[model samples]
Target: MHKIIVTGLTGFVGTNLKKYLSSYEIESLSVRYIPNQKIEINADAIIHLAGKAHDLKKVSRPNDYYEANFELTKQIFDSFLKSKATVFIFMSTVKAVADKVDGILTEDTVPNPKTHYGIAKQQAEEYVLGRKLPEGKRVYILRPCMIHGPENKGNLNLLYQLVAKGLPWPLAAFQNKRSFLSIENLCFLIKNLIENKMVVSGVYNCADDEVLSTNELVQIISLALKRKSRSIAVPKSIISTIAKIGDIIRFPLNSETIQKLTENYEVSNKKIKTALEIEKLPHTAQYGLERTIKSFINK
Candidate 1:
């Protein structure tokens, strides 16, 4: 049996990975520092998912991201180099690449991370990419976009509530295409990468093949909620002026909310597709979104 160690076993993605990887002898590791030498030496693969998530509230400490994301990752990765671990899978984010992409985000894009969260993740990628591993061993830096699936309780839930309550979405004036990764799809890729020996070491972007507009997302959400979509088209100019005021007033449609609603950053899954060399991934993007929405409705 393949021996694997998965950190952050309680996280959204890690929880998905653990249930999916149950066939393997996977150890659930929860640590803020380097793991034990015994586990370090014995594991066939190490999928590191533990890290400080991006703080949207902006109330978090400045260096917290660096300490939790960069320092902790560096500690484990450095120890992995000294151990017999054959594969080190680092869960990075497309945010580490760019704050805003002109088009689809690919593996080749230059990293220009905007937030402390993004910067810290990029620094961690740099730390791993800077090292050389033992022969036959490989490292993968996976930059996944906004991942959503079962048990997810964040901004998506708020959107779901709007759709569920049949509230007219005020941001329908915003038109943007965004890429989202299904936690199922991400786990599928990780399992495939670990199982396939020919899959070499390098950075890869992860997402479902499809890109959908936020309007389209709302429609899917509406379908799951079994309700009519009530997205409205207020004049953008008026909204922009109101948002400028709301920047101070902290209205729901303020600058940050506008960015969240209107920013178009479609991550390309083409590289990962070609890398895996399969005709289709496990789930379509729309299918995944609909599933997640339904999951929320059920909850």
Candidate 2:
């Protein structure tokens, strides 16, 4: 059995990955940002998932992102270069490339991160690519967008709650499509990368093949709950004004949250799909999303 050492084992992605890769011998490694800290690798592959996620509330310090995302990644990657681990997978976010992608985001997109979280992750990606790997070692930097799955809690959960309470979605006026990554697809890609030596080492964006609008997502949530989907097409201007007020009053519908809800951030998984020699990911966007919504209802 291939032994895999995974960081951030307690996190959403890490927890799901552990369950998904049940055939592999998995070892959980706890990691935190400490200056000059070094890691010891004893497994055939290492999946680095431990890092500071983007702080939606804006309460995190700027240096905290650098320390945890960039510095910790640098330390662990340096260890991988020296150790016998044949595969090193770094979990990065699509935000590392661009917070707001104009068109479909591809592997060729140049990075221009807006937030500290994004910039820190971008730095880590550069560091990982800057080093030279041994003949037998392979490194893969995966940039996943808005991952969701069972037992996951985030904006998707918040949306599920709104639908569960029979509250009409108020942002239907704003039409936008966003890309999402299913945890199952992510785990499948990582397992393939670990087992398939023909796959090249480089940056690859991970996302479902299809993009869905917020309205469609609400419908999916409703379907999962066996309820009719309701949406109010209030004027965009009125919603913008309300969101501005929300920013000042600390309500849930602030400018940041509003932008997140109505953003056109589509990511392309073409490179990864071609590398894995597959026509499409195992799950469709609707299938993965419905599964996530059902999990929320079951809880």
Candidate 3:
């Protein structure tokens, strides 16, 4: 069995990934940002998932992002360069490239990250890529968008809660499609990257093949709850005004939340799929989403 060292084993993605890769010899490595700290790697592959997540609350300091995302990554990656670890997988976010996608985001898209979080991740990516790899070593930078799965308490969970409460979705007027990445698909891709020698090392955008509107997500939630989906096409202008008020009141419907609920951030997984030699991911968008919703309902 190929022993794999995984960081962030307690996080949503890390927990799911550990279960998904149960067949492999997995070791959990707890990491924190320590300046000039030397890390030791004793596995064939290391999946670096221990980084600061994008804070929607906006309470995190700018330096926190750089230290956790950039500095820690630089340190570990430096260790990988010297260690016997043959494979190094860095879990980067799509935000590292663009906060909002103008078109279907591809690997070719130039990075223009506006937030400190994105900028820090981008810096880590650059550091990894800028270094020359040793012979027989492979490095992969995965940019996943809106990863979701069981036990995930992201925006998707909030939406599921709204539907479970039988509250009508009020932002139906906003029509937008956003790409999502299933934890299963991400784990599958990572497993393939570790096991397959033919897979080239480079940046790859990870997302489900199909893009779904927020309305579609609501419907999925309702289906999982066995309840009728309800939506009100409140005017965009009216919703915008309400969201602005929410920003002042610190309510649930702030401007940031509104934009997140109604944004067209499509990511292309064509590169990853091609690398895996598969025409499509093992799970369809609906299938994966339904599974996620069911997990929410069961909980």
State the C-alpha lDDT per candidate.
Answer: 0.85, 0.92, 0.91
Candidate 2, residues 86-204: lDDT per residue as tens digits?
99999999999998989899999989999999999999999999998899899999999999887786889778888999999999988898999989999999989988999999999
lDDT of candidate 3 over 1-299, digit per residue (tens): 28999999888888888998989899999999987788999999999999998887789999999999999999999999999999999999999999988979999999999999999999999999999999999999999998877777687877987898889999999899999988888888988888888888899999998999999989988988899999999999899999999989968888988998999999999998888899988887777788888887777
Could you tell me every candidate's TM-score relative to the true structure? 0.95, 0.97, 0.97
Rank candidates, lDDT, best first.
2, 3, 1
Count of clashing residue pairs in every prediction: 0, 0, 0
Q: Candidate 2 vs candidate 3: which has greater lDDT? A: 2
For model 1, what is the alpha-carbon lDDT of residue 178?
A: 90
Flag regions of model 3 displaced more than 4 Å.
none
lDDT of 3: 0.91
Show the colliding residue pairs in model 1. none
Error of 3 at 16 (Å): 1.4
Model 2 TM: 0.97
Query: Ten residues in a row with the worst lDDT in model 2?
Result: 149-158
